[model samples]
Target: MIEESQPGPGETPPALAVSGLAKRFDDVQAVDGADFIVRPGEVFGFLGPNGAGKTTTIKLLTGLARPDAGSIAYFGADFTRRLKAAQHLFGVVADGNNLYPELTGRENLEFCAALYGIGRAEARNRVEELLERFGLDYAAGRRFGGYSRGMGRRLCIAAALVHRPRLLFLDEPTTGIDVPNAREIRRMLAGLAADGTTIFLTTHYIEEAERLCDRVAFIVAGRIVRQAAVEKLLDGARDRRIIELQLDTAPEPLLSALSEHFPTNRWEPRAGKRLRLISTAEIELAPPVAFLAERGAAVLEARRLRPSLEEVFVEVTGLAAERLSAEKGGRRG
Candidate 1:
């Protein structure tokens, strides 16, 4: 179980906290002993491949499904026993738009507001405000079924915000949308975070998580492999720098010399004038350059490649993000 330190008097608790979170679907354990915390006003990302228990965990957290075991707390209060009571404090925008197809965009928001018991007049004002805020005012009167994929997603998000919940849960918000729309949605999420809304975002897009999340957790095979702040992970990976060198020819003696000189570094010979070097720690480039010069080898090019979040994900999960995405996409289709 993962436990958080007690908050000081009058201090705000974390936005959400979980300990020993586990769930199963018959014999399959979808989530196995997960634990994590989301601080207030930060965008926390939950990332994993297909069948990694991402959606199952979300369902358990949001009270859509009951967990087989674990505790869930929201804002320092125990919500595990009564999730419905805390539902008013957060909003959820599911993967699919669960809106009435025949209803107009404006009508959908109004309907959502009504569910929250907002006054009729207030609902009208709130619906209009959300339509404008989400750039759906131009299509406010159009039936939801008539809206494009991007527009439908935007309206769904707007509907989720009808009551102005302090916390927002987005499950694959930009999946299947066009690049322009995805970019726009990311901008809007940033704006929301700037306005002090705590966002829990689950996405397959590594670039999206790298750009938007303050912290990220990697899950694989129903277990969390790792969790950390994005910057720290990236910065720490600098030590394992990868350098690619282009040579005029592959010299067996030069390779032997490099092995004798730097036994810790990994060397890979590539086809046609290319050699790759992976170092576990920062090393002087001068030595390698001098060694090549001494061997009378002409260097065509040299470049250093920085590790990215995608690489980090692959390293931790032992699975390629692209492969995971493809598998999940096939299942969805």
Candidate 2:
């Protein structure tokens, strides 16, 4: 249990805080001087391209690995020095199946609770509740090794919550599951956050993060490039006034002529007749509409577009968001 070093009334401390965190493997720096604070009861997303030190950072935060240089605090108290004592404060959910494959789902949860020193009666009730809540009651007696990927993943999450940790650390929560299962897992995370559990998740799905996280941090090459509330990041994105045009003809060929007319704007072709004209400055529609008309290309539709979170990610990290999605076997979530 966490020590009762509570802050004075009305003073809310961050759920987790890190300063100057650094980790290295051989000659490569895995995590470089990372720093961030996680507020109470918020879903925080750590986003980055592959090899960006996201996994290493989570390991450090969860005490699975020691940092070469840094300070870590949990709710204002330094946790780095008291790692073992702080074990009960949070739970980790990653790729591996930590539960015993030989055991049944109910048995796995009961054993997890036992590890936390919960009483037998309490463990039984908690296990049953978790099994039902995760929709695993139907297969409670099934061996973990025989369970489907989605079922096992759900059980992994249930095992983490057996002790009801105050903070949860998850990595790529929905990387390889069916759409229905992924959606269910997202709903579980949303419910956890609503009930005041602080959640820190690293994900490749930019769409999922945008939908679920209260705040997000962009990490690149072992460093945290940016961290802010989702609304704040999107607000900055809103400043870019992109315009989308649906033309009668394929817009790819017209890019050259459009460039000559609107040299300052960037033209990108989408599928078929959809064209995106992106610019930071205000985009007047009349000129482009008139130009298209004069060229005998009908302007089927012309609408203003807001820069997407994926586009903003590319701007900050200089890495395409497609890389993350593509590696995860999905383009959107």
Candidate 3:
């Protein structure tokens, strides 16, 4: 059975719920019948390639654009009908560097507070507090344009939190960040979830979603294909037995022979003289190793491989595994 993000009957109200959501621009249908829900205080990830209606869906949810059809609810209240009344409950940080470049980090946050109708005195305190909380106090006086990519991203998040909203929407929060800095950003987000902040996040990083989200929805070709809790998703794939065999020579020559000898196993020769073996039946180490040894192939390594989020992503989305990193996939998305 397919697990859904919808709350069960008599369950606590969802932080956000979307049903039959759709949108079209000109001749192109950007989002089609999307459905999902975010539980309060949990980090919900929306994952897709570029232009897979991720941005459009965010716009629809944030009230920046209207959907052609569907319903959106926040805490059981109809958000589509009462967006302005519930504005204070939300904070949004766009994917790009929207914070003013010329302004100092502290000043930009203060300005955002003012826009949120925070009192001048309260805004001052909030700005300073956010700077320190985000580890931007040292560069709070520096122009935002001079900040590193990671620092700028943190400040943008701090600006979004100036009003201390309950629900925060973040787009590509860690895109293009260096290793140490990206890790820092992820650590900060985990802390937010711990503090009961509901985060609706859209990102290109599959591993990031697996790490941070309680639940995740995969969007493809402008449609939501699947949604489930991260643990359940991983648990479902845990039983899949995948074995990788490394040899001194390419495994292509052995494919036909292996298929003939072990018809129950699926074999594919990969790059780097490696072969992937998949089977539902038990895989014995002896037969294949002995078979390869007799065929003048040197066996280097043989190990069971764990399934990953990327594998499930490609499976559910029906995208070629090789195209996950390709630009054509983005265009199709």
TM, every model = 0.81, 0.85, 0.86
For model 2, the superposed segments whose C-alpha errors exceed 4 Å read 1-10, 243-261, 267-276, 281-306
Error of 1 at 152 (Å): 1.0
Model 1 RMSD, rounded to 1 decimal: 5.6
Off by over 4 Å in 1: 1-11, 243-278, 281-304, 328-333
Better of 2 and 3 by lDDT: 2
The positional error of residue 55 in candidate 2, measured at the CA in angstroms, is 1.0
Better of 1 and 3 by lDDT: 3
- Cα deviation of 327, candidate 2, in Å: 1.9
Best by lDDT: 2
TM-score of 3: 0.86
lDDT of 1 by residue, 72-188 (tens): 999889999899998898999998888999999988898899899999998998898889999999999999999998899999899888999989999988888877888889999
lDDT by candidate, in order shown = 0.83, 0.85, 0.84
Q: Per-prediction count of colliding residue pairs? A: 0, 0, 0
TM-score of 1: 0.81
Candidate 3 off by > 4 Å: 245-263, 266-275, 285-302, 320-333
Q: What is the lDDT for 296 in model 2?
A: 83
Residue pairs with backbone overlap in model 2: none
lDDT of 2 by residue, 151-178 (tens): 8899999999999999999988887888
Model 3 local distance difference test score: 0.84
